[model samples]
Target: MIEYVARSGPPEAMNCPAFICDACRQQVVGAGIVTWATTIGDGRSRTHSQSPLYVAHKGECGRKVEAMLHAGYPASDGWIDLWDDIGDFLKQLTHNATNAFTDDADGEYHQHRLEGASTNGRMQ
Candidate 1:
């Protein structure tokens, strides 16, 4: 499944060396959004596969991603079931961004940490 996450930090400290916004095709220097996927196994056990990260700017670019997804844009490999709970995802994204903050001192950007909601309706 596809998921959205809000993160903030120095660009160099992110999981990727550089986050290229999938929507605007620009480098994300600070607070930005990330989309990835998680795979679960049967009840006996569970596993996860890391899908290609889809990063985007937190506000407008983030909205663009939502629009593309709604219009049936092709998702990354292993993200075949993106429509499962998109409405909820959009809510989470909007809430997170709306509540996020910025850091101007020393060029560090800080955004509020908002966890994604799991399929079970709990924060993940």
Candidate 2:
């Protein structure tokens, strides 16, 4: 699995190590986040937790990634910009809503099971 983390600093501060965008292949400097992925093998997987595999693109390429998300491009396409605050907010909202539904379903299932058990005992 690959994960991209966002950095708060500006692009110029990222001088020593830089990230390149997988979509546009542009060098990412400054405020962009780093991405790390594990290399999968037949038996064992090599982890790149210490070393970043790619640097998220900022500036023009970053803009393009944001545009892709706005244009309905899927995150699976590697064009989704997760660093944006708005996107994170929306994701959180969706997660919360899903959790609420799951909670409701679980409550209903438990209630029905309890009712069924009580009725079964009484009939016996």
Candidate 3:
């Protein structure tokens, strides 16, 4: 339930058991770095309005558990949907940071630079 940034411990020092799901909580089955990015503005507005996200690492969105850990939130004691964790992340970031986001309601979903982007016009 507690996270430790050890200076002299395991190499990766995987996150605590609490930050993992029931499927992998007890094991460090796979390891990879988490990534995130935030963007702001809709329509024509321009500004930094979002925050980096660690939605998934190779299709694994462990962010929900990460956010909970960051806020000192304990595990739910039951299974939780990934989006529910996303909802919690959204609320926490909205309240804790000054960044803001807005949707243009133009049938378009926005993405931050890290939200699957590439050098060319084609999406990654």
Candidate 4:
């Protein structure tokens, strides 16, 4: 029988990281954050967790982050900006919110699960 190794905890950050977060609209701070980026068109997608970038969401926030990805982010001002902030950083992300739903949009959140996902080294 083939044995599988199960991992735990969040993945480590990498160099040349591209952050894609949901800048909290409530306070000056954001929450439920998962910032990462991978090599484009490498014939494979890797999440910081060492799993597929499209790994299923474990909580409400993780799920929302996934949906935002599906919507897409367009580059502007010669900047491939994907950063979002609630306080003074909000301006940086406004350019990507034309037809896309704002981070504070309705249904953008999900319920958190205690535990379940376990792959490579993340919650999968």
Candidate 5:
């Protein structure tokens, strides 16, 4: 299974860093966040695979990742599949990020989850 984690600070040199913001498509300079994916095997003799790190600006752009997760893009696991439309995906991420706080404040997010769970415990 692959899991992604975000950490404070720029990516280390050993990770073959690229200073590009995955969400905003901007060059990342100081005080950035690094997002990387790790794949671990399920068996006793587990193997691990690390993907190249994704860097993003610490503010709005970085928050898109959190928002995308809240919106449940990759419902199961692994990296987010952008499919063929990267532009559309970015737009969705931005929209979700922009509405994240407002949705939470209005309790709409929780209500939506409750409705979904009551209807079916699976992604429709």
Candidate 6:
């Protein structure tokens, strides 16, 4: 099915039928949001004839589905797991940025300024 962003009109303006989100179980309707469809099983073990279509809110349910697929997990109830994943991902990003900063060694001297700073109860 063709998925296009609806620039105007109501949320339920889409001609397609509404469906519940696989992640949050929320009702998704209309053309503005994202539409998802997938076929179940591989042709090797099982036939790919089984296919299911769904409509979802792009920001909420759509993100959850994308994260689940990226992390290689089935859609589960609640957003706690997704939140945890996001937290971890953010932590990694911080770590990587920090590493990048530290890794940059220019010709300029990296000075540890202790002037006017108190150290061990005495100003250094």
| Rank order (by TM-score, best first) | 5, 1, 6, 2, 3, 4
Determine the backbone clash count of candidate 4: 2
Screening candidate 6 with a backbone cut-off below 3 angstroms (N, C-alpha, C), the clashing residue pairs are none
Q: Candidate 5 lDDT, tens digit per residue, 1-124?
A: 0123344555543333345666776656556666544444443454443333345576787677445433543435543422212344356667887776565665532111111122322222
TM-score, candidate 6, is 0.27
lDDT of 4 by residue, 49-123 (tens): 111222112256555555544334222311121322233233544555654545656634332222223454332
Candidate 1 lDDT by residue in tens digits, 47-119:
3333343566778987776555433423443233222233445577687686654533444332222224345
TM-score, cand. 2 vs. native: 0.26
Model 3 score (lDDT): 0.35
Residues 82-122, candidate 2, lDDT per residue (tens digit)?
A: 45333343466578877774566544322111111222211
Q: After superposition, how far is residue 91 of candidate 5 from its true place, in Å?
A: 34
Q: Give the TM-score of candidate 3.
A: 0.22
Task: Give the range of the ten consecutive residues with the poorest summed lDDT in model 5.
Answer: 109-118
User: What tens digits encode model 6's per-residue C-alpha lDDT throughout 1-124?
Assistant: 1234334466646554344455665554442233222334344564332112233455767676655443432334111222223334346657877676556576232322122222332112
Model 3 spans > 4 angstroms off:
1-4, 9-33, 40-45, 52-56, 62-124
**With candidate 5 superimposed using the best TM-score fit, by how many Å does residue 75's alpha carbon deviate from the native?**
7.4
Model 5, which residues run further than 4 Å from truth?
1-18, 41-44, 66-75, 78-124
TM-score per prediction, in order, is 0.35, 0.26, 0.22, 0.21, 0.35, 0.27
Write the number of the candidate with greater lDDT, choosing between 2 and 6. Answer: 6
Q: What lDDT score belongs to each candidate, Candidate 1 first?
A: 0.48, 0.39, 0.35, 0.32, 0.45, 0.40
Better of 1 and 2 by lDDT: 1
